[model samples]
Target: MQITVIGAGAWGTALAIAASRQPHAHRVVLHARDAAQAQAMQQMRRNERYLPGIDLPAALTITSGPLDALLPSARAEDLFIIATPMAGLRSTLQALQGVPASVAWLCKGFEAGTGLMPHEVQAQVAPQLHAGALNGPSFAQEVARTQPTALVAASPHASVREALVQAFHGSALRVYANDDIVGVEVGGAVKNVLAIATGLCDGLDLGLNARAALITRGLAEMTRLGVALGAKAETFMGLSGLGDLVLTATGDLSRNRQVGLLLAKGLSLEQAVTSLGHVAEGVYSARTVHQRASQLGVDMPITEAVVALLDGRLKAFDAVQVLMGRGPRGEAV
Candidate 1:
């Protein structure tokens, strides 16, 4: 099968490498946005800037050509993985409007201005296309190294899910099929925001009890917003939900967690963001998450607090206090 992965960021590169490493000889192409970067990766056989220390497999083709260059390869039997961030999903889908292939994205956040999830954006931009999302707890670096990882291939359409499974699922990587795209996308997106909160909790030297409590409640917030958005409540307990939240909140390699750690250390938001040199989806999508929750009349206290903190209206220490100061209420999911 021919596979084209658009957007050559760390996650995109990792997935391209993984696909190329599959036991079967499937043709795979990794597309970078910049022509120079594409040439560099092709020549050096490594994605040094984003995925340093990982060798690109000989079987993976690297390209920085125009979007039209991908059209010829977009057959019904092939898959186009939009590996761009949430912000680029719309334009990428727009570019692939007429392609006859299953499309999936690696991004896990709402669009910044429109506050749309990846599938929502796809619906608006290219509703005729068969699309879905591949998401779970796995990190780009870990997956690039061929570490064991399990992910959910979520789509209302069975073909998109099956294409994802056929193209990538293998001995070291497991892909589960899920029909709940809304639930999976919600879990994938909200976990980043919750990870920021967890990072702040840990950065403040809060004990294990605090961390556990915050994570449990954070999962509640996620589930609330997800169910309000038409997702299955039980999906929150699955890989894309509980598994992803725990991994992002606690993983040392999480960019969103690193943002909170830097902020807790007295670095300004700008300073922390600039230091990371990559998009931390939590910082960009916290407000949107809060907005969506408010629009849905869902109580997302943690998301509201995160929005406040990200907006510079509240300090990190005060943010914690605000969360703890909320009126005591009965525990509910």
Candidate 2:
């Protein structure tokens, strides 16, 4: 199988290394938009700007050029994984129009301004393409080191799921197929917003009991919005939902969590974001998530609180106060 990963960020480089190291010797190409970065990775055999300590597998091919030139030779059997951030997904999918290949995206967030999920964006720009999301609790650095990780290969199309499994499932990686793309994508997008809230909870020196309460309620909020958006409720209990929420909210390497921690330390949003040196999806997508939930009449208090905190409308402590001050309601999700 030919696995072409577009975008040479940490996750893309990590997945490319993993695919190249497979015993099946699949052809894996990691494409960087910047020709200079591609040349550096080709010559140095490492993505120093992203996955620094890991060495790129010799079999992995690094390329960069216009999408028009790079994608013309793509075959029907090939898989194209878009590893760009949510902001770049639409443009990338637009470029992939007419390509007879299965596509999957690794980004996990709602699109800003449009408030659309990746699949929704694809439907608008590349509806003919067979696409899905490859999402789970795995981090880019851990995956790059070949750590054991299980991910959901979610698409309405069986062929997309099968191709993702064939290309990625082996050794330290486990790929599970799911036909509920809506459920999978909702879980992916909402978790980032909830993670920011969880980080704030932890940053304020809240007890483990508080953390547990926040995560549980956050899961309920995620399920409510997802179900309102045409996703199955049970899907939130799966890897892409509860699993991803737990990992991103508590994991030390989570950039969204880091943003919350930095904010709690009294840094301005600008300072915290500038210090991270990486795009934290929650910071960018919190407003969109809140907006979509409002439009759908879904109660997403945690996400709403996150949006307020990110927008400077509330302080970290004030956000917690607001959440705690809410009137009692039924426990239904």
TM-score of 1: 0.99
Q: Write the per-residue lDDT of candidate 1 for residues 1-333, one digit (tens) a residue.
A: 789999999999999999999998789999999999999999999999999999999999998878997797567988999999888888999999899999999999989888898889988989999999999999999999989999999999999999999998998899999999999999999999999988888898987898899899999999999999999999999999999999999998999999888888888899999999999999998988998898899999888988888889999999999999989899988
Cα RMSD (Å) per model?
0.8, 0.8
At residue 319, give the lDDT of candidate 1.
Answer: 95
Clash pairs of candidate 1?
none
Q: Which candidate gets the maximum lDDT versus the true structure?
A: 1
Using all chains and alpha carbons, the TM-scores for the candidates as numbered come to 0.99, 0.99
Query: What would the per-residue lDDT of candidate 2 be over residues 1-333, giving only the tens digit for each residue?
Result: 689999999999988888888889579989999999999999999999999979999899999998887688888889999999999999999999889999999998888889999999999999999999999988999999989999999999999999999999998999999998888988888888888888888999988998999999999999998889899999999999999999999998999999888888899999999998999998998899899999989888899888889889999999999999999998888
